[model samples]
Target chain A: MSQLLRQHIEKITPLTDSEFTYILSHFTPKKYKKHQFLVQEDAPVPNDFFVTKGLLKASYTNLNDGKEHILQFAWEDWWITDYQAYFNETASSLTIDCIEDVEVLCLSLHNREKICAELHKIEHFFRRKSNAGYVALQRRILSLLNSSAEERYHQLLVTYPQLFQRVPKTLIAAYLGVSRETLSRFSK
Target chain B: MSQLLRQHIEKITPLTDSEFTYILSHFTPKKYKKHQFLVQEDAPVPNDFFVTKGLLKASYTNLNDGKEHILQFAWEDWWITDYQAYFNETASSLTIDCIEDVEVLCLSLHNREKICAELHKIEHFFRRKSNAGYVALQRRILSLLNSSAEERYHQLLVTYPQLFQRVPKTLIAAYLGVSRETLSRFSK
Candidate 1:
């Protein structure tokens, strides 16, 4: 698990073994069974989870309609959290739960800041990650605004083909903001 | 203009005058007239603009329908770019243009990386900014997924009331993914 984190970080910045070990000490490894909640609405988000294994989703549920809207998904080498809540130290506006039995390394905001302040390279790695994440979200927003449901389906299929196999069709529909029947038409 | 940049950076991380001057040295100040393009689709994107005055929008045009989708708007103290193109050194997929006669401090990717590499605080500032941007985009995505056109209108109106006065209703409609008629109805 530590090796996984080291490799992930090293993709952006190289880390000596001792440095990797030092950085790894700030994270606490946690595991959850399928369907277990990692974050629940209105609860404090204490940490951001870096996934080593399994799948999870962060979603917002409409209070008036009781409909779930999928915001993001995380699997191997991805990070997941109620980022607004985590960064702002507020109650969560979304819920995160395991789609499969999961293993993640959890880093609290305090520890994250501490490590960032201590290691310039770690700070660089995080900044690069955040910049990449921002670009990705921008692309998603553009897709949502510009693409038809069918086009969105095809785009997602081509971009993250693994998602089609791992995520249920219904959830894909939720993410794409299309009805299941509509998504069926697209997939067909 | 330099003060604006310094204040923006200082909001996240304090800097000495010499340090601020050193940081400002990496940026080139540029101005654009209303409707002039800072970035055009299929052109290389080289700089990320920090808006010191006026407003600009980043948007995508649908090739088939000849319709536009507004991705983001930047005004005083905000940063705007074709981030995907800028970060990856690719041709732009979107167009960024001045909404008003604009003044911006342009920081090329090379300079951005140079500063981040040389100054840990600048990297920290950028990381913080990116994290906040990620959270904002996440919120926008959630709203797009869950809210009605009317609800979204009210959310935008309340959140950025200045936009209502400054931006044309047609562009606001574009941003909201609604018809101008629908936006009018919401306002009424």
Candidate 2:
């Protein structure tokens, strides 16, 4: 557990055993089987999970047409949650479903508040992470506005090459705001 | 100046005069005339500006078609910057222009680093701000994927009604991934 957690933190900042333990104390470990739903739309989100292994996709379906859009994908070392619900304490508008059997380090809003109140440095670490997430989403919005379907597909390949293999092509196509047919043609 | 700075801090967390003064000391007052560029595409961005008066728009243009997309609009009490550039210390891909003659409080990377190092509470405040920003961007991306032109326009109005009056119709339409004509029709 420490090894997996350390690998994730090292991507952001180096942590000593004491620091890692301090952070680890706030999280609880859990495992889920493939096709498990971590969160469901319209339900309250109680916790945010950090992926230790396997894959998960956060998605939402349009009420009018019932078409689903993949909002995000998480592999090892990534965090997954219905962020809108997590932050605002509202009913979730998205669902997080496991694509592969998974292990996660889960932290609830209660634990998170305690950590922020007690360990301020950890708060700083999360702040930096959130800033990076914002930057990535901003870039995605810009790409949607300016890039062609082909360009976005190429970008996904460049940015998250691992995602192509880990996620189904149909989900990847949805993520790129294109049809699977378009993605198939682009891949060729 | 203190009142404005205090208001900014209180938006996230309450701070005493000494704490507010300590934070304010790190910000440098800046002025830009109408149409002045605060940041340009492919240029280094070193600071985030807090608007004290007037307004600004952060935007990018497509090289192929010369079409522009407005990423965000900043009014008094709001923060603006090429966040991708500021946080990453990379050349900016977006440019920020003074949409109206403006006065701003600028915080450089150096000062921000010092604040994070010396004032732990400031770091927590920043973390909360970043979290909120990340949530907003995530919602925006989801809207782009699932919402229609009119739905998006309506959502935008519900989210940022002040922006409707302050920004041009074309810029707002572009941000919503629509045309000015379509936005006009939707608004009616």
Candidate 3:
């Protein structure tokens, strides 16, 4: 199990076996049943979870309309969290719920700090991942600003075809910033 | 001048004078006049600029409409780049333009890699910055999904009040995902 994670980390930086084991010691393996809430809105986010199996959705409820807008979906190898609350140690305005039965490696904020102090290269690994995340967010913002609903849907299909299949269309529609009816029409 | 950057780096990680000097040596200073382009759309992005003085905007032009959307604004102490292209070494789809006369410390991808290799703590500094950026991006995504235009504008005002004075209203409106007219109407 640690070998899988070590391989992932090795893709970015070469980590010695001992270093990989040292980093792995900080993570706690956790499992969630389908539809279970991993993190709740308005609650403190203390950890970030890396999915080993199954799917998860990060979403926020619209107060005005009482509708949930999916912000992101994570499958195997993806990290899921309420990043704002996690990093700031503040109450989260978002919720992460299991879309399918899930097994995840959870790392606490405290443990993360320890890893940074103990293994320096781990920080570089996380930094590269964060840089990639920043780019992804920038792309999403541009898409929302300029792309049509159909175009956005098409982009999602092209970029994350697996996610389209794993998640329900309604959730995918919300993530794409479109109505379910619109996604249905566009799909046809 | 370097003292200010040293202070910024110290905020995240403690670095000795020699280490700071070594890191500074990797940066090349550059200047840009107002309205000048730092990077152009569909061009290779080789460097990331750290603002020392003045303001800049990074934007993407919609190919279909020829309209541009501002992705972000950089003032003193802020970093600006088409990160996607910078990291992947691909042609950038975005352009970075100076909104006000600016001075920046430029670091090319090659030198950045060299710094990471030589100074391990520098990697930590960048990782922490990237983590903060990721957190901010997550918040921006939530703002777009859950907040009204007025709410987003208000949040932006609270977070970056100085930006209103530094950047034009049209770009600010675009950053908040609202039309310039809508922002003007809301302000009144």
Best by DockQ: 1
Top TM-score prediction, candidate number: 1
The local distance difference test score of model 2 is 0.87
lDDT of 3 by residue, A40-89 (tens): 98899999998889999999998878889888899888899998889889
lDDT of 1 by residue, B5-29 (tens): 9989999999999999999999999
Chain B TM-score, all predictions listed: 0.99, 0.94, 0.97
TM-score-best of 1 and 3 = 1
For residues A98-145, what per-residue lDDT tens digits would candidate 1 score against the true structure?
989999999999999999999999999999999999999999899889
Ranking by DockQ: 1, 2, 3
How big is the positional error of residue B147 in model 2, measured in Å on the Cα after superposition? Answer: 0.8
lDDT of 1 at B155: 96
- Clashes per prediction? 0, 0, 0
lDDT of 2 by residue, B63-131 (tens): 998899888888888889999899989999999999789999999988997897688778878888888
TM-score of decoy 1: 0.99
At residue B15, candidate 3 shows an lDDT of 91
Q: Report how closely model 2 matches the true complex, as a DockQ value.
A: 0.84
Q: Is the docking of candidate 1 incorrect, acceptable, medium or high quality?
A: high
Q: First chain of model 2: TM-score?
A: 0.94
- Stretches of candidate 1 exceeding 4 Å from the true structure: none
Better of 1 and 3 by DockQ: 1
